[model samples]
Target: MRKLSCLLTGLMLTAVPGVCMAQMTADTRLGVGHSVTDADLRAYFSIPPSGKGLPAGSGTALQGETVFTESCAACHGEQLQGNMAPGIGADKLIGGRGSLATNNPVKTTESYWPYATTLFDYVKRAMPFNAPGSLTDDQVYSVVAYILAQGKIIKADETLDATTLPKVKMPNRDGFIADPRPELSLYR
Candidate 1:
């Protein structure tokens, strides 16, 4: 009787996993929201520097101004100067050009960000302090263009898309240097 009980328990454990695996591998489309299609998989992936995974849609600085005013102005000033209110310390996004040499260097988007693609990526992933991860791809591009244009990084007419976004040069593009420290730890 003990041997039979042990055998049944082992069989149940093995069979349960097999059944679960089969269900997971089987018609995933009919299951809960965990099942994802190719399109769904594509949406969550990050866009590379080369814009390999860039989603469709385009935006201009003009349209971006509206979006920024509506969603961003409450915190980052209407002019994109960042949130300076008491207790809120949002960084400025415009000026700081040619200030890196000074004792007090201002690191705004125009002055510090290395790549234009980073702006789009960051805005898409996080922004609008009150709410994060809410902006769409097109909105991010448009907001990036608006901020860049305001900072004099790019011309007003230049539209930021996957192709052109990578091309827009940033002032501090060459400011960053690779870390020289060894990655492996030798702590005591």
Candidate 2:
């Protein structure tokens, strides 16, 4: 009787694993490999400086001003000077053209952004603070134009398109230098 009881217990334990495995196999229906569509993949990805993944929309500065006044002026200030509250602070987006070497430099769009593509890409990915990338292509273009104009880089009447945006020159275009660290040669 004792031997029979022990044999039954061992058989039950061994069968339990098999039963679980069989149930799992029956419940699941996944193939070896599957992927999302190209459009779905693009919805989540952002474009970067190398122009790796930009979208096809175009915008103009004239269109951007209306968008900026309606959406951005609250936090970024009416002139892009940045607003400061107790705990909430907005970034300054214009000026700081020649203050990079100063102790209290005011780094802004005029002095900081390396390329115009970067500005467009950044606005498209993140802007407006409360709601990011909510601007239309034309709105984006206009807001960029407004900021650039405030920075003294471009005129208010100037229209910005894909071709003209990249061509616009910033005052601090050559401000950034390539990294040369370690100081090994200097020490030697």
Candidate 3:
């Protein structure tokens, strides 16, 4: 019994170091995660309403139509209308101009979204439903232009880049009032 007890104690102590060393040699640091690089952080694609984070790219609504037809139409529908049919659910992209004041409001791109830059940001970051963040910046701009044009928010011929997209006003630009919550108040 005494020998067995020491043997068990010896085995446990031996196993403890082996388990500790195992993680050290496995290329992971304390099981936290891989070290992040600037590229990884930059990949988030968080473009503000100011269009500041927009990457270098250029495209027109005409070009966007092609990209949208190929990548977006499946989920968004043939007319950029929402897919509420059976199991296919997606938001409508155009034509809901005056519904905000109505009881049954249909908030589409033209009716609800305030900033054109946000449209580009959303498409660039989370779009095509199936493959998020797959489209290039140029394709994002084009798609934004196409959707805006369809809603008559922007001219069909207008080219949407970082510079112009922020400037293109939407119907709902003034829909949002300044958030006047007390906590957000400036120190007086």
Candidate 4:
């Protein structure tokens, strides 16, 4: 009787995963989650450096400061010094200007990033450390504006949107050389 029970439990354990996988791969439904749709893909699409895919909303540095305090300060630090926690080491967002040429260069946002648009793209795609892609476009824009303002990269009053964001040049704007390789020409 004991041998029979052990054999049944082992078979059940092995069979459960297969059944779940089968359900997950089925065309109709997974019984647990709905299939991804085109709209969902569009929601998570990348915003290129040209600001081509940036949403219509806009935000200011003041508004961004509030949003940052609520969503980003825990991981990135209240002053953007970066969290010192073991696994949650968020990067410092401000300063580090003119250090790129030095041996101990501190690559903060103001000093390292080549384009402000890329900042917007990164924040939109992955941020808040815990819940990525959860912030609305306005919230993302506000946080970006705040960070840039803190770094002195842009005026605190400067409003960032699709048109203006791509124009806000970074301190290292001219530092990056264009890729000379032919295979990567399409990206240029």
Write down the worst ten-residue block by lDDT for model 3. Answer: 17-26
The superposed Cα distance between candidate 1 and the true structure at residue 66, in angstroms, equals 0.4
TM-score of 4: 0.75
Scored by lDDT, model 2 comes in at 0.68
* Candidate 1 residue lDDT tens string, 104-164: 9998897788888877877887787777779887888898889999988888888888889
Ranking by lDDT: 4, 3, 1, 2
Clashes in candidate 2: how many? 2
The candidate that achieves the highest TM-score relative to the unseen native structure: 3
| Per-model TM-score versus the true fold | 0.74, 0.68, 0.76, 0.75
Candidate 3, overall lDDT? 0.77
Q: Write one digit per residue (lDDT tens) for candidate 3, span 22-118.
A: 1223346456554434344445436678877677888898999999999998888879987786765788888878899999898888889888877
Mind giving the per-residue lDDT tens digits that candidate 2 earns over 11-74? 4533542232112222235555333344444445455445555555555556666787898878
- Per-residue lDDT over 41-87 for candidate 4, one digit per residue giving the tens place of the 0 to 100 score: 34544666788767888988999999999999988899999887888
Candidate 3 Cα deviation (angstroms), residue 137: 1.0
CA lDDT of 85 in candidate 4?
Answer: 89
Which scores better on TM-score, 1 or 3? 3
Where does model 4 exceed 4 Å of error?
A: 1-38, 43-45, 185-188
- Root mean square deviation (Cα) for candidate 2: 15.7
